[model samples]
Target: MQATQADFTVLFRLLSGVVVLPLAELARAFPDEKLDSDAEDAWQSWLERFAARVSAEAREPELRVAEMKAANPKYIPRNWILFEAYDAAERGDYAPIHGLLAMLSRPYDEQPEMEDAYFRQSPSWARSTGGLAFMS
Candidate 1:
C-alpha cells in the first residue's frame, strides 16, 4: 500500500524529533526569529506528533545556541556573491570576495551590512539558475 502524505509527514516528524530537537532547543534559547514563521510552525507540529510515537528514544535536552550553531549555517554565498567574488578575483579586486568569506565564517553575529547585502534571500540570478538551493 502506498503511504499517504499524512503518513509521510508523521514519519518526518519522528525523524525531526530525533535529529532536530537539538536545533529546536537552540532556537528557543536564542529567541531567533528565523524559525518563527508559518513554515516553522508546521515543522514544529510535525515534530511533536512524531516525538509521541518514539517515547523511548528521548534525548537529553541540549544547549540550544551551541547546538544550533553546530548544525545550522548563518550564511551561504548565493550565486550573485559567487559571481561577484569571481569577477572581483579576475579583476584583482579581491576585497569583496574576501569580505564575504569572512562574513560567512560568523553568520550569527550582528553584522548589519553583511545582513543587508549577503544575508538576505538568494539573489534573483541565483534563484533563476537553481530555484533557491541557497535556502538550505
Candidate 2:
C-alpha cells in the first residue's frame, strides 16, 4: 500500500498524539521570550493544561496544520514590492503602492500579470529581512 492509501486521519491523529513532548520543550525553551503580558499571564495561569492541549493538537497533524494555515498564509507581498512602493513614494508615485495593496488583498489568487515578477517564489532577501513567504 502506498503512503496515501494509509488512513491519513489516523496517521495525523497519531502524529498529534506525539506532539506533547515537543510543545512542552518549546514552552520551556521560550519562557523568557516577550509576549503579550495579559495573554502570557493567562497562559501561565493554565500552562500545564494548555501544554497538554498543545500536545493533543499536535497529535492530529492534519488538523494542526490546517489550523495554523488558516491563521497563517502561503504567500505575502514581497519585500521588493514594498521597497518599490517606498521608492515610488519618495518620488511622489503611488501606483506601485496601490498595486501592491491590491495584490495583498487577494494573495491566494495567481495574478497572471504579476506572475513574471511578484508571483515568483520568495527571494532570499525576504528571509534576510526576516520576512517569511507566509504572512501571519
Candidate 3:
C-alpha cells in the first residue's frame, strides 16, 4: 500500500507513544494562521483514512536480528555513489569502483566508514543535474 505523511505520523505515534495531531489541528491549536489551510485539511483527512486502513492490518511478523539482517542487507549502493564511482573511473581513478565492489561483496555486514559515504540518497545538487546522476 502507498504510504503518506499522515500514515507515517500515525505509525510514529503508535511506535513512539507520542501524540502527533494533524497539521490542520495543530494549526488550529497553535496560533499559526499561515500553517492552517483548506488544502492541508483535505490532505490530512485523506491521510488519516489511509492510516486507519493500514492500522487495521494484522501485526507484522517479528524476526530475530540475524534472520532480519540475512533478509535485508545492511547496505545497498545508492545511485549517486555509483555515479561518483563511474565518473571517477572515466577520469582514470578506479579506487572508488574497487571500494564499492569490496562493500558489495559483504552486503549484509555493517561497514561503518562506508555508511556515511556510500549508503544514502542522492544529494540535492545531484538531483536532475543530468549526466551520470540521471543515467544511473
> CA lDDT, every prediction?
0.50, 0.48, 0.52
Q: What's each prediction's TM-score?
A: 0.45, 0.37, 0.49
lDDT (C-alpha) at residue 48 in model 2: 63
Instruction: Summarize candidate 3's per-residue lDDT along 1-136 as a digit string, tens digits.
Output: 1222122222222222212345443322121223335556665776577557546646542333345456556556656678788999999999999999999999877787876554443455565677636522
Give the alpha carbon lDDT tens digit for every residue of 1-136 in model 1.
0211122212222233343463344232121223545646666676566556445445444443345445545465656677778888999898998898788888555466775465443444555566333431
Cα deviation of 88, candidate 2, in Å:
1.0
The pairs that clash in candidate 3 are none
Task: Please list the residue runs of candidate 2 whose C-alpha ends up more than 4 Å from where it truly belongs after superposition.
Answer: 1-75, 122-136
Candidate 1 residue spans exceeding 4 A from truth = 1-62, 130-136
Task: lDDT for model 1, please.
Answer: 0.50
C-alpha lDDT of residue 69 in model 3: 54
Residue 110's C-alpha lDDT in candidate 2?
A: 41
- Judged by lDDT, which candidate is best? 3
User: How well does candidate 3 match the true structure in TM-score terms?
Assistant: 0.49
Query: Residue-pair clashes per candidate, as listed?
Result: 1, 5, 0
RMSD of each: 9.1, 14.1, 9.2
How much is the lDDT of residue 59 in candidate 2?
57
